[model samples]
Target: MIRKTMTVLALAASLGAAVGFGALPAFAQTAKATVDAGKAAGTVGEQADGFLAVVSGGDAAQRAAVVEINTGRAAVYKDTAAKTGVTAEAAGQATAKQLYARLAPGQYWKPLDGGWAKK
Candidate 1:
């Protein structure tokens, strides 16, 4: 069961990276970094707490999670991309594309959702 899940995940990530509207593992890498940064800084946790603390806040909570995950994870990829001379915008675009591809309908990374300007 575990192996199957892992395979599926790997496949999905590959698919996402491959047909990511021209983006690839590169973009996903940065997105992951951003998520890590948020987690390490506890921002992701804070956002989750703040969101859950309020009423009718499920959306908020989910949104916060996305933010935390996206920001932290993206940072990781961003740093690597930077050292390698990859443009932030390219990273951002890759992040956005991958996030969109990975997320289900009505769910997505906040920074990547309709916030193309920032990306």
Candidate 2:
């Protein structure tokens, strides 16, 4: 019984390793997919820093909303990456500012208009 158990354990370990090794290529493919998505999106990393910049001016509520938007973008990136075999993260990092610029303008505060005003 002891010997049988040992053999079974060894087999399981080997199988796990094999499965893990097999996953590496898939992971690499996922990265490529993300890049493709970024290109297709035409706005990968744009959200993070842009969201941060806008959040700085708004109230706490605004900050939370911006964070939610950024998180949503990341989730999309992950899904796209998983499907296409490109690295969306890398693409986002590479041209975040450019991407942000391309993005539609977000909330803007106008003091004279009378909402919030400036501190």
Candidate 3:
């Protein structure tokens, strides 16, 4: 079961990296600048579940941007999950791995079972 799940996750991650995260929805694109700025400023980070998170000291605008981005991501993850036969959570985690690989230096990320860490 574990092996099968891992295999599915690997396939899902590949698909997400190749297409899912690479192509943001129109709504997400609109908020991308805000999230990118927040990330550069150390106020926002990508979480292990394929969503943006406010690490610290985020204002209302940044919070709103996070919500917008996450909502878009949830939609994408759900679609990907349906196509890939995995749970939406699993699809998000797969995408998260791809996102983590693309993180820049000085950025923060939180693992599924750990506190935030800088890369």
Candidate 4:
């Protein structure tokens, strides 16, 4: 019984590693895919708030994807703010600048003036 239990535990551990326990959540992965699609279609753009914005209307799935990605970004901003002695909004804005600069040439971005522009 002891040997059988050890073997099972080892198998479970291996399976977990194979499946990547530390990998990003399924929602996050889905969000990335949707964001890519939205960007290509010009329906979504990166906002100055470190979240995605719908420059134009999108489908339900795209909206859900943006929600997931924005939630993750919000959490990150809050955590960084706590560590850096700044407000969450400040951290988010800082991250937005970095991410905006990394946008592809034809990608859309929402500047502080509240309109979308292609990069």
For all predicted structures, in order, the TM-scores are 0.34, 0.36, 0.81, 0.76
* Candidate 4 lDDT (Cα, 0 to 1): 0.69
lDDT of 1 by residue, 1-119 (tens): 45533433333343334322234366454544444344343333221111101112244444554554445445544553454455444434444444444434333233422221111
Locate the minimum summed-lDDT window of 10 residues in model 3.
12-21
**Candidates in descending TM-score order:** 3, 4, 2, 1
Q: Candidate 4, TM-score vs. the true structure? A: 0.76
lDDT of 2 by residue, 5-83 (tens): 3443334333222322234355444443443244233322223222222413344444444455455445544444354
Q: Largest lDDT belongs to which candidate? A: 3
Task: Please give, for residues 1-119, the per-residue lDDT of candidate 3 as tens digits.
Answer: 57646855776556554433566667666577788899999999999998889999998989999998787778877787677667888878877888888889999999999999999
* Superposed model 3: Cα runs more than 4 Å off: 1-27
Q: Which candidate model has the greater lDDT, 1 or 2? A: 1
TM-score of 1: 0.34
The parts of candidate 1 lying over 4 Å away from their true place are 1-60, 106-119
CA lDDT, every model vs. true structure: 0.38, 0.36, 0.80, 0.69
How far in Å is the alpha carbon of 21 misplaced in model 1? 18
What is the C-alpha local distance difference test score of candidate 3? 0.80
Residue pairs in clash, model 3: none
